[model samples]
Target: MEMKERQQLQYEHDLRNHFDILSLSRLDRLKHYGLHFAKYAGRLARGDAEAKSRNETLVDAFLVALSAANALNQKLQNAEVDTEDAPSDLAFTDHAGRFADACEKIDHLEEFRSIALDANAAITDWIVRNATVRGVDLDALVDERRKQLAQRAVYAPGS
Candidate 1:
């Protein structure tokens, strides 16, 4: 076999042996969590905090989801999954564009924070509602996460 073929075979072998299928499964679960975090950040951004904090959290959540999806895409690429055969490959491209758009919004937060907050909340609320037909109770989730963080701080070794 050629060197490239040999390397491909080795990569496949290593992936099969070292990969945990559960990680791939978890990636799917993370999609919803990421969207939730984005929506939550949008809601918070409408408040008095600095623009950087608000934009950062929204961008961070989006990047995390994009990163997870990219990892899975890398595995599929290694397996030689034909792009034409996988509609998800096209979806991934669409997601990459969304990620880029989020980054661009972050770049302009200082000048447009208030406007961005309202727009972000509107767009994210629609997305959240579409994702979960009943819609998310943002206040409840925010309260729960805050409590969890406070509990962690109290039990932290340094404190």
Candidate 2:
């Protein structure tokens, strides 16, 4: 079945509820969001360095971006619904360093709250655009990922 486009906040809520993040304290929940963001941000930096647009990594980065928004209690609704494939932007250049730098600042996020949110949102856009450029189905991929996440052994079933 085809999945419809959803807001970034919907993704965040799905993740939180699916993973029982709602049960944790505010600080721990922030940590949870931050950890996922950091993990994918690092991976994205590496992938960008090689100029490889791995579909899975792109989705992961998108999810991480959502998590970053969640950590800051910000409404992130920048998902590009029904995006169509097009040529890669000619202006595309190495953004690995900037992404890595964003990850670093977000790691110590309290001091750079606003920018961290912006960086994460930017990461989300980059991932979507890159995936589209590579002729990938990001919505389908993310829907599959959401299913996998829901069934993962780590989380109790049927949360």
Candidate 3:
């Protein structure tokens, strides 16, 4: 392939990886909400207190945003553009500002999980795609580490 074509492929690969990592981060956040926040919201909604409904609504909105952010990050990471630097308008100050604001308002609320989940997913996805597009196997360096601990369990001294 021509140099330009190769470069284009590289860009695409990198973008996709970035998005995958981002998605991973998002998934983590959703998992957190699924485990904790969602229940809290449900409780508030069912409680007799007047503020409960509003609180639940707010929490629900934040959760939705968290999900959206995760999905978007995953898409970007999968596109291999993890480090492509989001445009200014899409930066945390912009796209995630609402999330940040919601987080600040939440005191007893659990820690926001969106960023962590999205980032991990984006990075992991990027690595996988990058290896494939570069015609290299990352199994030894990447997969080995991820699977080693699990594999070790299967071969434990007692087993």
Candidate 4:
């Protein structure tokens, strides 16, 4: 099964109310994505972070990017268009840096919204590209993660 960005966004949105993720202040949401992205990228780059494998870090980064994109109001309607091959030369750190720069610049431009959303899609594309190259079953991973999120929601303090 292919990893569909729109579907992933929908799943994140569905879990938003339960986790109060999307409702977070813009800076907080950006921090959420940034921190997770940095942590996972560190693990993937250094081969250290808990007992998780590199691919697991990749999945974490990918999911956070998708959720961050959605929080930034990226409609993800351009997923098909953005699915075109991203440059394979960039390292995971480069990918993480680009995403952080993108998110950070959202407040710096007069037309930053569109530009940031484009960056959001671009960042997601790079991860998807890496996943494909590494033969990671993103669909399966996402499915498992979403299920876990749903189950957690059941016992959420306010849910």
Candidate 5:
């Protein structure tokens, strides 16, 4: 296969492996949420109207994931939940935090933010490149999606 094709395949393989690992670890909620993010990102890269309408930029997406990891870490540290459920959250939080913390210091508060910013940059580059290859007019798509979203907001319940 061509080098680009090979890279794409590898990316897909890595994503599947990561998903499998998360699922096997019984973190299905997190796995499903992550998968949805991936799927939405893919759709946006492919110029899907609804996905674009969601208005989730790469930065927004990265922040959401980072926030979840941070929340998990905080919850684990605080130990506000029952003991039986604490172990699993603690384990998952530690693993998630380690991705950002080179030293794995419990007090490394900004480590995850740095990781998330780097990840956002990489993901945004990848998505823009892929969307260009797909002949997606991102600016036009965003404009249209914004109009649709605005209309929806106008008629939305309690809005």
Candidate 6:
């Protein structure tokens, strides 16, 4: 199935499973939480305690969505969209939007964060295992890609 179709199905599943737990009325509320959290987090480094709190709250919601997606065997890269092409008005209609709501409803963002971190670490470990078996270093391949990007930047116009 296409990414959007998968997201739609996933959202439907999340709604069926967690809607009772969240007590949320609409998906848009989650979108609002995410949007406000991001906008606020940008100012968090400026010493705004409230913004920091809000930032964590929003992140918590995102983590909940991530957890749900993982449970449903969904791919994050497939669910994520290009920022420029993302719909501002229909924010509540996508996987990202559902994540925003989940984060907002989750009071303990730290647990969610740790879970995400662990998941990433596990993936890295698996990749390393497979690469070692094949006599390849994934990190070196990534570094080579980065070097190529840097070289391109150096030769680019007005650089």
Top TM-score: which candidate number?
A: 4
> Where is model 3 poorest over a 10-residue stretch in terms of lDDT?
86-95
Put down candidate 5 lDDT per residue, 40-97, tens digits, no spaces: 4554446555545433443233333433333233211211222222122233233333
Q: After superposition, how far is residue 57 of candidate 6 from its true place, in Å?
A: 32
- Candidate 6 residue pairs in backbone clash: 30-101, 60-103, 61-102, 61-103, 61-104, 62-103
What is the Å distance of residue 5 in model 1 from its true position?
Answer: 59
lDDT of 3: 0.38
lDDT by residue (1-159, candidate 3, tens digit) is 222332343334334433343345543444443334434434444547545543233323332333443343433333443443322212222323333433443443655445434543333343334344544434333333323323445444443
lDDT of 1 by residue, 44-64 (tens): 545455454433333333333
lDDT of each: 0.37, 0.56, 0.38, 0.62, 0.37, 0.39
- Output the better candidate (1/4) by TM-score: 4
lDDT over C-alpha atoms for residue 103 of model 5? 21
Off by over 4 Å in 6: 1-110, 152-159
What's each prediction's clash count? 0, 0, 35, 0, 0, 6
Off by over 4 Å in 1: 1-99, 102-119, 127-132, 154-159
- Quantify how close model 3 is to the true structure by its C-alpha RMSD in Å: 17.2
10 residues in a row with least lDDT, candidate 5: 74-83
* Model 1 root mean square deviation, Cα atoms: 18.9
Angstrom error of the Cα, residue 120, model 2: value is: 1.2
Query: Which ranking of candidates, highest lDDT first?
Result: 4, 2, 6, 3, 5, 1
Ordering by TM-score: 4, 2, 5, 6, 1, 3
Off by over 4 Å in 4: 1-18, 48-50, 77-90, 102-115, 153-159
Candidate with better lDDT, 2 vs 3: 2
Candidate 4: tens digits of C-alpha lDDT, residues 16-91:
5336766678767875676677776667656553588766666666677777766776654433433444444346
- RMSD list, candidates in order: 18.9, 6.0, 17.2, 4.6, 18.3, 18.1
Inter-residue clash pairs, candidate 2: none
